[model samples]
Target: MIMDNWISIKIAAQGPFDLKRTFESGHSSFPIPLKDKQDRWYLVMRPTSINTVIITRVAQQGSNLVAEISCPQRELKENEVQSMKKILRTTFGLQLNLAAFIEEFKKDPIAPAFELYRGIRLTRAHNLFQSLICSILTQRNSIWRWNAQARTMAKLLGEKYPVGHFLIYSFPEAKTIVNHSELLTKASLGYREEYVLETAKTLANKEKKLEKLKKVPTNEAQNALLELKGVGTKVADMFLLYGLGKMDAPPVDIWIQRAVSHLFFKKKEQTLAVCRDKLNEHYGKWAGLAQLYIYCWARDHLK
Candidate 1:
């Protein structure tokens, strides 16, 4: 069922929401939002079950958000619309209830960070395969470099759709990636090329196994992700937190380790395991979100 024009949908945020802060929170794994001349933010993506490129113009309206979504290449079905709504909700953390976490940590040392990045939310990847590849790319890599590589990969291999005067791309599927594995080298993936291709082959062969992690316990999912090539503790934690929505998995990168050391360990160097345990003890289920905030704050203030 193709519509003649773009369809509009309204989604209500469960709590305080800031579109700008959430979309541009410096999470390299998440797709970057493009701003038009009118300053409207638009994100282009594809539903997991369909190849049609969906374009959404997101705007904040009071306590609710408006997503003016359209399938530029075809008509969107009702079920696809529903799936898009769910994806948007998860991507923006629209259903996250942070009231208790905010109130409890309002006076803590990281409290200033909470205020500084008040409306920011944990932004997840569009899919597990994308997240896994991104985690591999980020290993021993600068943020700018990895992000560029991701965008280049998408541009070269992803499906492109023309919306209005602009052209946008949806991240390529696993099979497409597997078939076009050689193109990845052009993206400058370097040593990560083998890991990414092998991961894509696994996803193409056993996608159900990867998707099943979303419903499993955090520790169990982390263990399974660790079995994949190029996945270490940090990469496994990243995939669990950002890909599987396991909020208890705190990704202890260098920035987060430094933040935890200074704030909780009195400037003493702490092991990554120690930082993870401290974050879990202090923040509990919200440890992943806390890690995101601390990472952003440290990147800005610590340097």
Candidate 2:
């Protein structure tokens, strides 16, 4: 916990926890507007599960990015903290090492300059119901379609927050969505609706017991997440990686499958076993970090 003059902290070139992306993925809260806000990503950190909820603008200052941390639980110790600085120096870039990783990217600096972020975070689900539902929407569809389903569902269930023109909303909970489950199904979820309801119901039944999942090992956590319908390996990995905060967890969606094929496997005929081995060998437990960087890069660069 570091405390310093707010202005000086803001301009410190780099800091950890300034990660522009949301720890949780389902929410529209982390606004990565296409063109308007180019220099920084507007994001809300630690929104639901954690008390560290704050809307902050994330931008790189010098070598490390900086953020205006706003969690109520944080007591910025009078002792100026350097923990933030350390995280950035270690996590940024794709080659995996901080400064070393940056040098690897220097070979093609343009892409790394704007999109990639560093650091490994252990996040509480942020919003379990939201992620569970979004995972359902994501099943068997392209990311584009998945986002559309989630957006529509959010508008249906979320309570709009008025922040000028930025109309963001919090994702609805299982208890709340239960009342409107019919509308959820009717909106093209079709067969997947059962899985969505089953997931929500399971969470609803468990209540706070789901917190115990965090203590369970990653394998157990992933297995439990999959027991509920609609939760396959990728969705389970989503909960483990984003919700339970497992680092090495990587959800091998079709996009990742294709990307791995192009970069590592070099053949459409490669076996899934080879893909898993290569991914595991390269990234180990931090596979999610590697996945995200490649996923982000592939989204923009891949043919």
**Who wins the TM-score comparison?**
1
Model 1 Cα shift for residue 151 (angstroms): 0.9
Candidate 1 residues lying further than 4 Å off, grouped into runs, are 1-4, 49-53, 72-74
After best superposition, candidate 1 residue 258: deviation in angstroms?
0.6
Question: Which window of 10 residues has the lowest lDDT sum in candidate 2?
Answer: 27-36
lDDT of 2 by residue, 1-303 (tens): 222223223423222333334332222211122112446443333333333333334465544555443223355443323433332222222123434333444453233622444442223344555655666666676656666666666667765533323544446667666777877864567677788777777776454555677688878887887788778887777666655556656767665676777776554645554655566677676456556666655665675
TM-score of each: 0.91, 0.65
Q: Residues 1-303, candidate 1, lDDT per residue (tens digit)?
A: 232377787778765677777766766355566666755566666545565667777787876677788876677889888888888787777768766677877888888887788777777766667777888888888777777787788888987756556766667777888999889888888888888888888788566567778888888888888888888999888888887788788889889889999999898989999999999999888888889889989989877
lDDT of 2: 0.52
Candidate 2: misplaced stretches above 4 Å?
Answer: 1-125, 205-207, 266-268, 297-302
lDDT of 2 at 248: 58
Residue 97, model 2: lDDT of 40
Report how far off residue 287 is in candidate 1 (Å).
Answer: 0.9
